[model samples]
Target: MEKETTRIEAFSDGVFAIAITLLVLELHVPLIEETGGGNSLLKKLVAQWPSFLAFCLSFFSIFIMWVNHHKIFKQIYRRNTPLMFANGLILFLATCVSYPTALLSSYYHTASAHVAVAIYTALFVCINLAFNLLWWIASQDRQLLRPEITDEGIKRIKRNYLYGIPVHTLAFILSFVAPTAALFLCVALWIYWAYTSGKLDLKSK
Candidate 1:
């Protein structure tokens, strides 16, 4: 099980790396000729602020998810088919982020902005649900977790994972009424997770 866990983690890491790397592809260089001159190129680049913002938000969200995934696996001593599939679901949603992120950037301040932002937020909600399911499966019966992992620790982590769902759901809900605010909340959530890394840290006595 340990060997299998290692392989799964390795594969997951590869997926995360690929997903994060793909975000940069959405940021294209402005063509000087199309812009009329090099001076106007600067303005074109500046106009891409939405792209840059979306890239940063998605990049950090994936980064935080990767970190939490790594932490969860550290406590896992075994894996099963269900857990593997759940993890795969999480990765699939994460990889899908690039597309919605591109949409959000392209449709920013347009009629379609709300749809794009809602889609992006909805993807995150699914991703968070996947994480919660994966954790629940592994922590059940205490069969897959390391012996040193305390029940308190498991509960804490579960609470942390569970909290993400509604926050993201709220963001998705707000996306319809206020897209920019929804995006800001999403970014803020990721920032909160990044800064609260210690909350997920499990230590063995």
Candidate 2:
């Protein structure tokens, strides 16, 4: 079980790495001709603000997810069929991140900006729910957790993962009318996860 879980973690890391790397593909070089109308290269690069912002947000989002995933698995000593499927769900969603990121880069300045950002925001919602489900499944079987894990620790982790669902859902709803504000909410959530997730007490044996 230990080796199997370890392999899954390694595979998941590869997926996250690929997804983060793919984000850079949307960042195009500002061509000289594209900036031919008396526009400087710096100005053209600056005009691609949406691309840059999307890349940064997606990159950090994937990076932080990988961190929390590794932490979750640390306490999972035994595994089950449902646990495997839940983890697979997360990896699948991780790969899908690049698509919405590309959408943002392509349409964020146009009338479709709301749609693009909404999709991007919605993806975050899905990813968070997947993680919440994964942890819930893992916790269902106490035997799956490390021997040292306390009941309080389990409850704490559950509460922490639950925080994402409603927050992301709110952002998703706001995406339709106030996409920029929705994106700002995503940034805030990312910051929240970065600081709070590491505080989980689920330590491995």
Candidate 3:
């Protein structure tokens, strides 16, 4: 007997919520001396810009991932063992985001910045690859999809997912050579994905 997609989706949603919430823990309050005034506190906050940037980027990335996950699961009618494992992989990688976000926040501008950025981008690459695999598994011969979902829609989703692998891989490579540029590319990818909104036209041929 096949399992309903609801259980998987509910579990995935919990993971998303936990990951996003963990991101906030990376933003620490700055310590000030007794003589420090309001202006000094403001300066300290400004100095923690890297933490703010990492938090925003990771939050948006996970948010967009959750939205896309919802869109994909809407077309999936049932799940098998492999499909469950695939979805689990996506969530597993997503849960890893908090660690890298914290690393990037702490070392983004320090001498270890490149290493931190590389690890950060590498996690995203893994996440992207996991998504590609999950989509491929779910859409294979429409094996797990709803009856109303069309072949053309599956193909479109696969094509879009395929695009993410190389782009993220490139960003990972750039992390070694140009960490800042790679970080920017990662942000750009998130923005582009958010703009696309992951909605498929199930009625399309």
TM per prediction: 0.96, 0.94, 0.93
lDDT of 1 by residue, 113-195 (tens): 99999999999999999999999999985878887889899998898888789999999999999999998888888887777
What is candidate 1's TM-score against the reference?
0.96
TM for candidate 3 is 0.93
Pick the lDDT winner. Answer: 1
Best by TM-score: 1
**How well is each residue in 1-205 modelled by candidate 3, as lDDT tens digits?**
2548888899999999998999999998876673287788888888899999999989999999998888788778788888889899989888899999999999998988889999999998898888888888887756678777777778877776777778888888888889999989988888877766555535633
TM-score of candidate 2 against the unseen true structure: 0.94
Candidate 2 structure quality by residue, lDDT tens digits, 58-162: 999999899899888887877889999999999999999999999998898999988998899889999999999999998888888887888889988888889
* Model 1 spans > 4 angstroms off: 1-4
lDDT agreement of model 1 with the native: 0.89
Of 2 and 3, which scores higher on TM-score? 2
**Candidate number with the higher TM-score (1 or 2):** 1
Error of 3 at 88 (Å): 1.0
Span of ten consecutive residues with least summed lDDT in model 1: 1-10
| True-vs-predicted CA distance for residue 125, candidate 1, Å | 0.3
